[model samples]
Target: MVEYPHPVDIKVHQKSRFLDIAFDDGSHFSLPCEYLRVYSPSAETRGHSPATAKLERGKEMVSITQIEPVGQYAIKIHFDDGHNSGLYDWRYLYNLGKHHDELWQAYLDKLKAVGYQRKDPELAPPDVDV
Candidate 1:
């Protein structure tokens, strides 16, 4: 069985759609919801084979709508887009959290290569001056 260093604390910053996870081993990470959604372990995201995996887009602002415990090893996360099939094992989650920076940067690069923007270009920026 894979062993995970106990999490010293887990803080979900809903406004930022980021989870700050700190392990007792003195390691910590901030995982964005969009990254989690796109990297989901669900077959729908990763597919049966890597070549068959669908490239996800326009999810830079996605959020976790719910998090359900799955036994002692995993958590099933429900995304705002209705995807809830991924059962995130503790080890997987820990790995993702640990490598969030590299993974997220890679994802951004992929999005740029595909000429995809995270948010709609046609939409005007929200008016901040009032």
Candidate 2:
């Protein structure tokens, strides 16, 4: 059996909206909060399978409100947007980090294909639109 690497440290930088995770294999990933929110492994985001996956948009300003450990294998991340589902396991998180560039490019391509213009978080209005 393949031994998946385990995280040695994890830090949430709320100001920068990035989650930095360091694994035992000397690999590290700095994942953006927006990316994590959009790629959440929950039924609401991932659905039942890849064929039913949902594309999330407008999460550029999302931040990590909290991160709760699930046993020794996973962590549940809470976003400022009120989404708290999805348990990110070691293997899954590692894969996400390993393929960040490719996956991110694919996501960008999909958004472009649908003509979804991502708003600049610095210039965009708050989540609550009046």
Candidate 3:
């Protein structure tokens, strides 16, 4: 079993599209909803084989609609895009927070390599914003 810091608070900021988590170890992080969905533990993203992991794209506007507790160890995040299979355990969440920078950079690099573009809010028409 992987030992990890348990969360003291989990706050979903809809306006910012991020989940702020404070752990018992004094580590606090604001994990973006898009980041969570793209890196979902579900096979749809990271499968049994590394090569099977899909390069998630166009999720720039994705947000978590609900967060369901799974027993006492994990959470099943419900995304507005209908994804709810990823079970983010305490350890996994901790790891995500701890290594957010590197992970996010990697995802961006991968997307660039594959020519996958995430919807950019800045690119929106002047009349509307996403």
Instruction: Write the residue-wise lDDT of candidate 1 on 1-130 in tens digits.
Output: 6569766566656666776667767888777777789999999998999898878897766777888878866789888888899788777888998887898888888888998877732322122111
Which 10 residues in a row give candidate 1 its minimum summed lDDT?
Answer: 121-130
> What is the alpha-carbon lDDT of model 3 when measured against the actual structure?
0.86
Candidate 2 residue lDDT tens string, 44-130: 999998889988988989999999999999999999999999999999899999999999899988899999998856522222222
Candidate 2 residue 106 Cα shift, in angstroms, is 0.7
Instruction: List the candidate 1 regions with Cα displacement exceeding 4 Å.
Output: 6-8, 120-130
Which TM-score value belongs to model 1? 0.81
Q: Model 1 lDDT vs. the true structure?
A: 0.77
The list of candidate 3 runs beyond 4 A from truth reads 122-130
TM-score of 2: 0.90
Candidate models: Cα lDDT each: 0.77, 0.88, 0.86
- The segments of candidate 2 whose C-alpha lies over 4 angstroms from its true place after superposition are 122-130
lDDT of 3 by residue, 1-130 (tens): 6578899999887756788899999999888888899989998889879988888899998888999999989999999999999799999999999999999999999989998776765323222324
